[model samples]
Target: MKKKAFKEILKYVRVIVFFAVITILVEAVNYVMVQPGYARYIIHTVDNPDDGSDYDCIVVGASHGRASIDPHYFLEMEYAVNPINMCIQGATVIDNYYMIREACNNNDVKKIILELDYQYWNKNLKRDSDFGDLLVYGQLPFTSLKMEYIVSQLMDKDFRTIYFRRYAFAKNWKTAKKYMAIKKTDEYKNFQIEGVAGIETEGPYQGLGFFYRTKVTDKKGKLNPSPWTYDDLNPKVQKYFQKIVKYCKDNGIELICVTTPIPPSSVVSGAANEADTYFKQICDENNVRYIDGNLIKNEILNVSDDDFSDWEGHMNGELAEQFSEILTEILMKEDNSEYFYSGYDECIEAIKVRGNETKVLKYIRAAVFIAVIAGLVKCIDFAMMPSGYIRYIIHAAGNPGTEEGYDCIILGASHGRSSINPKHMIKSGYAKNPLSLCIPGESVVNSYYILKEACRNNAVKKVVLEMDYQYWTNDEARDSEFGDLFEYVQLPMSKVKLEYIRDELIDKDFRTVYFKKLAYTSDFSKVKYNIKTKLTKEYRDYDISAVKVCDANGPYMGRGFFYRENNNDHKCDFLVQEWTEDDISRKVIKYFQKIVDYCKDNHIEMVCITEPITPTAVVKGPSRDANTFFKDICSNNNVRYIDFTLLKNDVFDITDNDFCDWEGHMYGEAAERFSGIMSEVLANGNEEYFYDSYKAKIDEIERKKS
Candidate 1:
């Protein structure tokens, strides 16, 4: 039994050793090239040998603290204590508490200056600490403090990223290459990191981050501020703030919580005042000193827009110098802590504990290998999904409804889709149940099947084909056309969807059919993280945005009915350009014939509609443009043709005011008016279709114009 146990122990030791070697190698690379922040912090710590011992006073906060506090201000004043501004952008109260905790563990500190911003409390949400901790963890040393923060605050994914250096460094390979090349520069080598736990680093103005741009306009000029009434304080921030107070009291470190000076443009109505009131209450409960900078801005301090970098609160170097002087005077007069942070040698102990290799951690090594492999597979599959915007066409194509009847179905591009409202059509008695299916930047080739599907099982009594000269000139594969997945991604995996893919996409865009993400890959940009987060994730439900036909109430009234509020901008400025249908894409002519044939075979009433454009659209009086061509085709085939392109006195007049949103779509009233006109035509049949001789009317108008 003893011999067997010894052998098992030896096996475990070997596994532990294998992981230790890999971890050391990964961490060594991570220290130099994992994340920009990681490299910056490690270098700062390595270069600046002194821990928190050098700084008797520390200023801690977010980007505001880094940019608005001048450490040299205290150094120049030659106060009883040395000070360092330890700030990073997006550092919240939880992060601030960790900074203090790390500082107390390593530094000789007499006082702690917390630079609080009201903007931090503006969010009513419980902060997404998983994300917030990304900024905090990169610079933190692997101490008990860091371990606790990681365990309690970080998500499993974040924990994996931070603890496993290889995992953290893999995603940013290209960045690592560039950083490795530039990281050895003079500024990087000489960069200073002050304060315990290395919270402070090199800055721009005399090595201070505090400064403002001279050419940039005051940001407040761009926004129209309105009163924002809400009393929901961020619960997590309050909890962390209390924890910071307790840490200060327990350590015998004097703490001063501050709300920094902010300009009017950066603050919404009464936000600053309310923030100050809340902060005052928190301070009173804990018996900590508090400074409300907004309350004394012009009276005690004369900072202006000229002194700020932007409207959202950051003071320039000159203003920071002045602010620091005032702050120092206040602290010197009021500070009560005489004893400094002198006992803890937690840094060495932390290094030892972090360095220790354990047997159980070997399983984490095995798990990392498995998780990484699994994640790679998931990412590849996720890239293949077409459930985003393409879902609209898929949902419509795969619609399981068997009712083979629609009073009318409008087919074209986005204009055709949005121009006609099904609810209004039904309510006005033009078409009992209408479905407007518009796909942006779609070719008529796609619409042929879309219309066929719309009419498949439904008793679509009428077909309204929306067309303009442009609809007949699709020569190129539009960037938005984005071939295959638009047809296949959203469709249910069945013979019908599969056949459509094989017929429409197999030879059409074969490469894109396989690697479709490349279809719009050229549009991808390396935007900043903050911006990309908002753009990609916000309001991104394609089903809600794309599907216009909703029978939620009495058929989705006023849902897709859109009109530009301050219209009447002579929207027909396109009249400035000459219109022509002399060049129609062969594809358009083919689809037009197909539509007519399909309608006739199905015994469906086809309305070959020339949708209204701006007044200067195709000159219709006597010209042989798309309108005349469509009219001629409809006349030969005995189909009803209704041309509504001109604002002529005889038939219909659509002006800029008639269009509510864009180039040629009608407003609600205009749509209703047009719907009424169509209803009259369909109801009256051949005798009342044009209300008079349509061809004779066109010839009369032409004769008069000539």
Candidate 2:
């Protein structure tokens, strides 16, 4: 009795262990998959944040600081101070405070040059900015600072958006996107050799650390000046401004707030002037040094109205060159003493550890503990709630040995899934065990990828392709069940899945990669089905007798097809629908050719069969074009093409009653008959027993037709 009780307890323990392991793996994978776009400079700064890394004198602020200061200038001209322009676009004073604190921690810093852009003070300092703080977030290693910042933002700002990678990357998404998209191109490959980080010295950006916007006007063409006043100082920002002073003073880092040189029009308009006066007052109160660019804009910087194009100084590289030298001189003069460099490796290790560091995973064990209790008490369901289709996908992912290999493979959309019964194909002595690799809404592109996925584990020799008539023209195949979910989530995570995401899926939904386990649940039916089914094995059973899988969410695909089962009981007409060639995608034709080529190259015999469509549904031009296209591709590739679209015989005659619904997928009996016709054709020969004539009475039907 004790032994039995021990065994029962062990079962429960094992289940708990499974839950913990699965949850951690999901969270960890998601965290890695969503590692915000890695930029070269950002990575170097984060990884080598020490004296050895040569990032000694750090400059921090918004676009003005970024464009105004050049680290390479200091590295080449001064050789005393090593710096990186740590300024990002739209950076606020509050942003600078945290940045300063992090930089001090990460490097053995001598001084931090702060950009006192007055307009930045207008922003509410207590909140996070819409600007790309994610660049900093992605750059910073996991540290107390990062956690504190995350917590503070969560408490004060948009709580969920704080941890959201998409929201954080909103501003720079275009840059990151372009960088990723061109990754495979020869141009991109050649570009990578030039190095991703450093000064932009070649193109329009003739200077390091900034883009030199050519002066369009003497100061007027694109001279857009901001409407600012001294009284417009955001009170919350004033408070944080003082906090930065205290932090810098206490940390023994000399902080110099500088008002950068801009166009004469901005100063004349009272916006830049009034802000400058206010900054001096704040600097005087904090006992910090303040540099006035307006007083010395002409003398030291050598700038004129013609050179000053815009308020942001998007005009002269000469101004940047001169201004960066002055800033470096100011740092060189401040105390004239260098900081003691220690913890070179340690600082970088800490930053690297902190930047991509996450504590969310550490709590998984505890979460599972709480979750186990809750699950037992019906408090909340675990992520274990997967749809029937998801269940099949998850099962297909690990792919036990029983499912790895195959003799015959059926691939297509609902028409083929419902039409080609795998069991009938085997029972009729056509092939051995055949797995129906069909999903609803699959286009030609989707099928090609799905077929590739099947070929990974299965040693497939014969491919029974259900050539959807619409696929010939329509490249955009959406599944009747989960739409694009099966196109991705159903397949195990692999390079093929990533390729689907990168090349095919137009939206580039990262959630499919990051929140993979829950990505499909965003849709209504799938969410509801997952909740109802709880990813139960019973609802996701591979019916051994039928040689098909039943996905609860994929109602039609349960019979190993991608559509719901029916017996011609419910049939409704749509408002207006007919097959048309106007919407045909040339990509569909290309994919068909690709599929045939893949089969031939891999030594697999391909049999292309366009399953029967309802007589009423077929439009003459559209249907004929689809059939011709399918036939042409198959013939060009030496694959036997069977056109069952004209199944107008006695036994294989498809009536309105044969269809399951308006979509034209046939009922069980019709599906069985279609499968029988397919099997007999392959078993004997396409020319002899394949046409619309039934195999049992082919002679009589042929005579009648003659």
Number of clashing pairs per prediction, in order: 10, 15
- TM per candidate comes to 0.45, 0.42
Runs in model 2 with CA error above 4 Å? 1-385, 393-404, 474-485, 498-502, 505-507, 516-570, 574-582, 619-621, 686-706
- Residue-level lDDT of model 2, residues 1-706, one tens digit each, is 9999999999999999998997676545334334233233443453364456645667777777766676776777664466666776666777777777776776777677788887677642323453334445544667898787666543565544444444433235455554444444563344332333223331244322345544354525334455566566677678778888898888787788887777554555436666777788889988988876655523345555556545565446566767777766655575522221122233233334443544777679868976775565342223433444434643552353665467777777767666776776777788776777665566677778877877777788888788866555543334222345555655667887877776655333433333344333444555555554544555546322212244321344333644335533656654334555566667776777788889989998889887776554553225556677667767877889888765546547765567765556777667777878778877876564334433323344345546
Q: Give the Å shift of residue 102 in candidate 2.
A: 50
Residue by residue across 41-113, what tens digits does model 1's lDDT show?
A: 5225422434434567777888777666676767777753556667667778888888877766666677888
For each candidate in the order shown, give its overall lDDT on alpha carbons.
0.58, 0.60
| Overall local distance difference test of candidate 2 | 0.60
Backbone clashes in model 1: 10
Q: What stretches of model 1 exceed 4 Å from their correct place?
A: 1-14, 35-54, 75-80, 122-129, 155-157, 164-175, 182-221, 224-232, 268-270, 297-300, 332-706
